[model samples]
Target: MPNRLALKRKSAYLAQLGRCYYCGLPMWQDDLDSFSRAHNIKPSQAKPLKCTAEHLEARQDGGLDTAQNIVAACWSCNQRRHKRKKAPAPDAYLDLVQQRVRKGRWHCAPLLTAFGALFAGHDSGGEATS
Candidate 1:
């Protein structure tokens, strides 16, 4: 049987339509090997867009693993939030992420140009175009 947290994470991921809640980027749910294979990059380069379950209120802060508290996020976005000395609230972090996304500063240009174009199916700053 799958772990409860994994199930919740997958549920959140599916509900979010496979997009990271913070940066609105498509997240890869597979292992890094598959991600690298699919994207034609090394596993190290595939780390940023990996899917992860984020706790809105961190577990250290007494957050539960309930669906309401969990959200799907990209590895980069998830790591970005928690790496701060004092992590911002989810909504605040979300706003910050959106701003960065709109400005095309969230992920590097190369990642979006190659990895994102193949997986995310959108332009770096906005929607997919013909």
Candidate 2:
């Protein structure tokens, strides 16, 4: 059988329709090589767009790995959240990501522009607030 976390991640990915829950970008659930080829980016560049299981309530703070608590996020957004000294709540973080993604400040790689071309129709309006 597949690993539980992987299944959960896949479930979340599908639930989100392959979109990153945080940044609202397209993500690769598996096969970085394929993702790289599809996006025409290097493996290093593609790594940030891989799908990951995100905890709406962090595990460290007693959040369980149940489906209700899990959501799919991109590797970049996942890291961006945990990298903070104090990770913000999911809704708050979502707002922050929306702001940055709207202004195209969340991701700067040209590869993301190419990736966006593959899966268009994301409208992140408004400005990024401090």
Candidate 3:
């Protein structure tokens, strides 16, 4: 059974990423809908991870389900990754974070207006009275 958190996390991550990590292309909405949750860290033998409907990675141990843990992958890359034993690296994850931060860059126009008000003449309502 797929965890609700995993499914949600996968959706959020893919939406945030907006592109497939392996393919380096924007993911289509339909393709994104098809993305399955993938884990970066494998769970222990005593506590086996639950699998989803599309596919499962026995070696991955299925611990990773968070935004940082997963990536947007096409069907081919998803299958290729399943054959691997270890989780993908943090570079892609880090890049996503950096991209997000960059996307939120400060717009200085408002700040400049506020600062200019401090130096310029203005009424109590902050507009030129006369």
lDDT by residue for model 3 (1-130), tens = 7576557535743553443343232233332223222211222210111122122223246644455455444343345445456644435433543343234322123322322333234321123435
lDDT tens digits, residue span 23-86, model 2: 7777897699998887678888878888889998999999999999998888889999999999
TM-scores for every predicted model: 0.79, 0.84, 0.33
What ranking emerges by TM-score with the best candidate at the front? 2, 1, 3
Candidate 2: deviation at residue 122, Å?
3.8
Count steric clashes of candidate 2.
Answer: 0
Task: Report lDDT (CA) for all predictions.
Answer: 0.79, 0.79, 0.35
Error of 3 at 11 (Å): 3.7
Q: Over all chains combined, what TM-score does candidate 3 have?
A: 0.33
Q: After superposition, how far is residue 90 of candidate 2 from its true place, in Å?
A: 0.4
